[model samples]
Target: MNETENDYHGYTPMDYDEDSAADEAYQTCVSYIVEHAPIERDDTVVDVGTGTGIVALELASKCDRVLGRDIDDEWLRYAREKAAERGVENVSFDHGSFREPNVEEAVDVVVASYALYMAYDEGGEGTLRAAIEGISSLNPRHLVVADKMFFGPPEPRGGYETLPRMGTVANLLADTGFTLTDVEIVSGSAGVLVASRTSG
Candidate 1:
């Protein structure tokens, strides 16, 4: 049992149940992405912000390989345990930011759920763009980002105010040369936006 530090929040995977609302939201978001991803058994997928590795593990069942990356490795450990318990051998984990992943190459599709909204700083827009570019640089067939979009001014939380509008992400993807192929919003839900790269 390895204990992770607080600075490594991304590594600390939150405990979730299949019956919980968060879990349900995660599944809903993932399902939409999977539907639009065009991933196959021979393709490789990467799930960013892969807390507990649920999305990654589930994806592995349908893809040839899957890598779940998080800032924290503690959650990754739990993901590994779940994978082991489920006998899912194709999924793995890494502790790092998608902005600067340590992988030697990019995978097929990048699934980022509720992660992009957390990307904020003085150069927030630039950071988000760079992160998207980093993923796009891998030449993946698809890039799926599920974020919390607000309709008005955002409330103060975790020292962040005025959350980035969902349109921001869509525009960023477009600025980075990604085509807006799909945009599906679940009524009465926070919302999950799916975008992808057009095949040349």
Candidate 2:
């Protein structure tokens, strides 16, 4: 398959029931965020590239409102339907990119699961900078990032490559004015990083 096809296939939603490993890792990441992040009642959150609303739905249960933004309209639609089916009224989904999110007001927390790394690899430093700038504009108190960690060179996958180490991610967050607070490595190679905005 070509690069485009590979990339598209990589992001194609999987059946959660069939993918036990992925599901477990996802749940672990969600639990880590809930325990470590500053997510609380009355807080508004934005889940960037929120595919199918897994993280968004989880946050909705804890926070007052959650907006799940993704570039895929199909995923956003599915997320909205899933929220409704689950009777989660505090969550909503929209079509947008993490580099240029569509949220208007300042949110209390921003969570990106396995999404920012794709942006970083696809667009390189420019996309990474854009993502940080966009998140900064929201003035969030906390940020949560979860992705696979590559100790060596990033290996090619379905459509993209793996991300750098947790240290690299921490430096990027620090460059964007966020202070690293916590990190958890799970499923062996996959990990989550939580950061808080530094006071000016």
Instruction: Tell how far residue 116 is off in model 1, in angstroms.
Output: 1.0
In terms of lDDT, the poorest run of 10 residues in model 2 is 1-10
Question: In model 2, what lDDT does residue 170 have?
Answer: 78
Mind giving the per-residue lDDT tens digits that candidate 1 earns over 49-79?
A: 7777766776786888988877766667888
Output the lDDT of residue 138, model 2. 79
Model 1 spans > 4 angstroms off:
1-24, 121-123, 151-162, 187-189
Determine which window of 10 residues in candidate 1 has minimal summed lDDT: 1-10
TM value for model 1 = 0.80
Q: What CA root-mean-square deviation does each model show from the true structure?
A: 4.2, 3.7
Alpha-carbon shift of residue 82 in model 2 (angstroms): 0.5
- Looking at model 2, residue 195 earns an lDDT score of 92
- Backbone clashes in model 2, listed as residue pairs: 7-159
Q: Highest lDDT: which candidate?
A: 2
Q: Candidate 1 — what's its lDDT?
A: 0.67
Model 2 agreement with the true structure over 1-200: per-residue lDDT tens digits: 11112244555454432353457776787688777778889999998878777778877878899988887766677778888899999888886666577888768999888667665666666666677677667789988887666534555667647455566777778888899888787855577888999998
